[model samples]
Target: MNIYFNCMKGIVYKELIRFIKQKSRFFSALVRPLLWLFIFSVGFKTALGLAITPPYETYITYETYIVPGLVGMVLLFNGMQSSLTMIFDREMGSMKILLSSYINRNYLLFCKMFATSIVSTIQAITFLLIAKWYGVDISFLAIVITIPVIIISSIILNAFALFLSSVIKQLENFATVMNFVIFPMFFLSSALYPLWKIKDSSILLFEISSYNPFTYIVEAIRFSLYLKFDIQVFLILGISLVITLIMAFVGFKSKKVNHG
Candidate 1:
């Protein structure tokens, strides 16, 4: 029992130290979303007006509506980035050594996922604070309530990327996979614009966005920020976390069996 706890603690500390050393990585994570919040939102706010939406009582500016999406963006990208580290560790033989310990492989993977989720959650909170400073209107209470939602969303996303890492054998391949996964997931979802807008633009996109797991994650965060809970969103997120963790564990287990 204590061994498991200490192992998780060590993994979390190592990830934090690595994140701290990579100052550029942290900045880029914040910069990507901030650019969307500040620059892209400014240009689109006038061109595209948002109507009253769920978790929002009245019409909102594009900036306000996209805050949760940007938060999702932080989780999504950081999740993928953490998987990149996994691949790096694997290729460097560190992952093999880590798993060589008596610790269960699945638990180790979960620890890694949880550690990265913590980093992603921190980044999301920091982004929200900056958004508040920039006048996006997130209250302190909302931030507090949204913390657990952020953690859940982060875990799901990290599990997703971890599953992807098991299939990807090389760092180069992950870059391609990340592009294939990240952009389409971001653009197709209700992240930047609402689903109604997507429906107006293209029915195909609307249908796809409805099924995108990232959509539910974005919505979960959005509603949580308003102190709202949607059972449907929670259900979807719960299912996603379970599915991804199972797939990720199986994927990594196959590799271990084959290599051993």
Candidate 2:
């Protein structure tokens, strides 16, 4: 138990240190979402007004409607970025040494996921604070409640990214793969627009977004931000978290064996 605790502590501290040193990562993560919030929302507000969404009791401005989605964007991008770092570490042989250290591999991976999740969650909370300051309808209590949700969401995203990292071998190739995965996932999902709107526009896209795990993640955070919960959203998030973690573990083990 002590060994596991200490290992987790070391990994988390190392991730935090890295995050602090790479100031660009912190700012970039915030900037991407802020751009969507500050620019895209205004541009789309008149053209794509929102009705009373489930989490929202009354009609909301496009800005409010999209805040949760932007939050998910932060998690999604940060998760993929973490995966890119893993690829680099793997290429540099540091990951090999760590895995070979023989601390239970799954536990070690969990520590990495947890560490990255922490960093992602920190960035997310900071974004939420900035959103609040920018006059979004976020309550202090809601932000407090959102902490756990963001942590869970971040872990799922990080696990998914870790699975990708385990499969993708080269850092140079990761950018192409990230683009292939990230843009489609973001644009197709409910991140930029609500499902009903998508349904109105294209049934195919609506169905796709319906099945998207990222959509559920965004909805979960959306409901939580409004001091609400959906059993359906929670169920999807739970399933996704389990499946992604399993895939990530299998991915790492397979790659490690192949390397060995």
Candidate 3:
């Protein structure tokens, strides 16, 4: 048991060290979400009149409305970024070494997920602090409540990335998957606006948003930020995590067989 714990600790430490060593990567991870919150949200605040959501007694600025989405964006991108790093590691032969360790593969993967999720969640909280400095009203408790949700969301996203890595077989293919998968997931979800806002324009788009996992993630964060719980968010996130983990497991298994 002690040996297992030490292996997990080593995995987490390696991830943190790698992330810190790559200063450029850390800055890049931070930049996109900041742009959305500061530039885009500021410009759209007047143009987009967001209605009062629950826990908000009166109408709020568009910037406030999309803050949760920006947090979600941070997690979403970071999760994918973790996947990209994994691919890079595999190409550099580091992943093979890690996998060749006597430690359990599933536990090793979980440690990877946990480490990446911690980084992503930290970025989200940092983004929130910056937003608060910009005059966004957020309770201390809300910030506390958001931690687990961000962690879960990050894990789900990382699992998806792992699944993608298993299928693509090359680091070069990651960019293509990001373009095809991440962008659409971000834009189509209620991350930028509420589902009711979309309903005003087209029922189909609204319905699509309702079904998207990203939508639930945004909603989950939005609710948590208000110090509330959304059961549906828990349900969707739980199910997505299960499915993505299964896919990742299958992918890892295939990789093992091929290498063997």
Candidate 4:
């Protein structure tokens, strides 16, 4: 147990050090979400008036409705970027150190997940604080409760990213695949727009968004931010947790092929 704990500590510290050194990463993370919040939200609010619904006691502006989804977006992007970094490290032979350090590959992968999850969760919290500072109101207690949700959500996203990193053959090709994955995942979900609103416009889009896994994550956070209860939130998370574990394991097993 001590060995495992120390191993995690070393990896997490390395990740933090890397994050600190790369100031651009931190800024970009902050800027992307803020742009959407400050600029895009303003444009959309006038174009599309919002309605009050579950997780919201009052009629919310586009900015308020999208905050939770943007929070998820932060984690989603960071997780994918982190995976890209791993792919680079693997190509550059940096990941060889982990193969040698830990006797088991799974623990090493878990350490990677743990490190990224912590960093992602911290960023989510920072995003929440900034959102509040921008005049988007949410309960303080709900923010406190959001910690666990962020942690789990980050882990799932990070684990999912790690699995992608393990399968994607080269670092250069990652960008194309990432765009293909990220944009659809973000736009098709209830993140930028509400599902009810989507349903009003087009039944086909609403049905597609309904089956999207990312929508559930956004909904989970959106509902949790207001301290609301929804069993579907937990049910979705539970299902995602199992799928991520299994899929990540497959990625771990396929590391050799990924390198080739």
Candidate 5:
């Protein structure tokens, strides 16, 4: 147990140090999400209208309604972006040292995931604070409730990144996968709008969004932000975490095989 804990501790420390050393990358990860919250949301506040949804008492501005989505978006992209960097480390041979270290590989990976998720969660909280300053209705209790959901969502996203890094042979190819997978997943989900709104435009989109894990994440945050609970979000997040961790394990095993 001590060995296992040490491994996890080392991995987490490595990830945190790496991120901290690269101040530019850390700031960039933070800036994009802030831009979405401050500039884009503010500009579109009037353009998008909101109908009454559960957890909301009356019609709200689009900016207010989409805060949870924005938080999810930050966690989602940062988690994936961290994975992309991991892939680069592998290709550049830096990850070899990590693999060869005394720590268990699985524990190391978990530590990495945990560290990245923590960072992503911190950014999400920052976004929430900014939203609050902008007059978004968030209570102290709601913010407290949202923390676990953000952590779980970050884990799911990081797991996806780890899986991708394991399978894809080249860094360039990772970008292709992101374009095909990530963007579509984000825009198609209820992140920007509610499910009912999507259904109004197209039933097919609504159905697809219903299945998207990101939809559940957004909904989970949306409900938590209102001091409510969403069972669907919990189920989707749980299943996604399981699947992602399985994939990450597979990737780690494959790497061990190739290296051995």
Candidate 6:
């Protein structure tokens, strides 16, 4: 038990240290969401109706409404970024020693995923604080409550990316993955708008977004921020987590069997 805990701690610490050293990472993660909150959201604010319904209540500013989704964007992008780092490390020979340290690759993969999740959670909190400064306020308790949701979302995303890594052979080809996977997931999901709003725009877009796992993730985070329990969102997130875990496990196992 101690050994496993120690390994997890070491992995997390290493990731944190790497994160600290990469100042650009901190800035970029914060900047992307802040740009949305400050720039794009401002323009879109006028485009959206005055009434946003629940989560944001009947009346709220666009900045306030998009806060949760921006946080989700941070997690989503960071999750993919973590997987990119993994591919980079593997190609550069940095992961060679780590892979040999554990007999079961999944255990080590979990350490990486969990640690990346913690990092993403921290980024989410940082963004929240910045949002507060921008006049987007939520209760302190609500902030604390959303931590687990962020962690779970992060793990699911990173695990899914890890599964992708198992299939993708070349590290240099991540740009294609980003274009096809990350952006489409973000744009199609409820990250930028509500399902009802999307439904109003286009039924086909609404259907695609409705089935997106990230839509549920954003919904879960949004509900938590409002001090509400959304059973449907939780159920979706739980199932997605289980499915991604299985996919990652199978991906890693198959990869190992093939490599050996």
The order by descending lDDT is 1, 2, 6, 4, 3, 5
List of clashing residue pairs for candidate 1: none
Q: Residue 222 in candidate 4 has what lDDT?
A: 89
lDDT of 5 by residue, 43-66 (tens): 777777777878788888877888
Candidate achieving higher lDDT, 2 or 5: 2
Candidate no. 6 TM-score? 0.94
Question: Cα miss at 54, model 6 (Å)?
Answer: 3.0
The clash count for each model shown is 0, 0, 0, 0, 0, 0
Across 1-260, the per-residue lDDT of candidate 3 in tens digits comes to: 99988887888888888778888877787798788888988788878777776757788888788889888888888888888888887888888777877777777788888889888887888889888888888977789878998899888888888878778877778889999999989988989987888999999988888888988888888888988777877799899889888888778877862244
Candidate 1's residue-wise lDDT over 1-260, tens digit each? Answer: 99999999999999999889989888999999999998999899999978897899987889999999999999999999988888888888899889878789999999999999999998999999999999987899999999998998999999989889999976888779877999999999989999999999899989999999999999999999988888998899899989989988988988863235
Q: Candidate 3: lDDT of 6?
A: 88
Which candidate leads in lDDT? 1
For model 3, the superposed segments whose C-alpha errors exceed 4 Å read 257-260
Worst 10 residues of 2 by lDDT: 251-260
- For model 4, residues 1-260, the per-residue Cα lDDT tens digits are 88888888999999999888988888788888999999988888899877777878888878889999999999899989888888888878878666655357778887888898888887888889999989998778889898888878888888888888888887788989778988888899999988888999999999999988888888889888988879987799879977986788788776553323
The TM-score between candidate 2 and the true structure equals 0.97
Error of 4 at 66 (Å): 0.6
Instruction: Report the C-alpha displacement of residue 158, candidate 4, in angstroms.
Output: 1.0
Task: Please give the lDDT score for candidate 2.
Answer: 0.90
The residue pairs in collision within model 5 are: none
lDDT by residue (tens digit), candidate 6, 1-260 = 88888888999999999999999998899999999998999899889865666566567777888898999899989988988888887777666567766446778889899999999999999999888888987877899999999999999999999888877899777889999999989999877877788889899999999999988889899999988887888999999999998898888667533233
Clashes of 3: 0
Candidate 5 accuracy as lDDT: 0.81
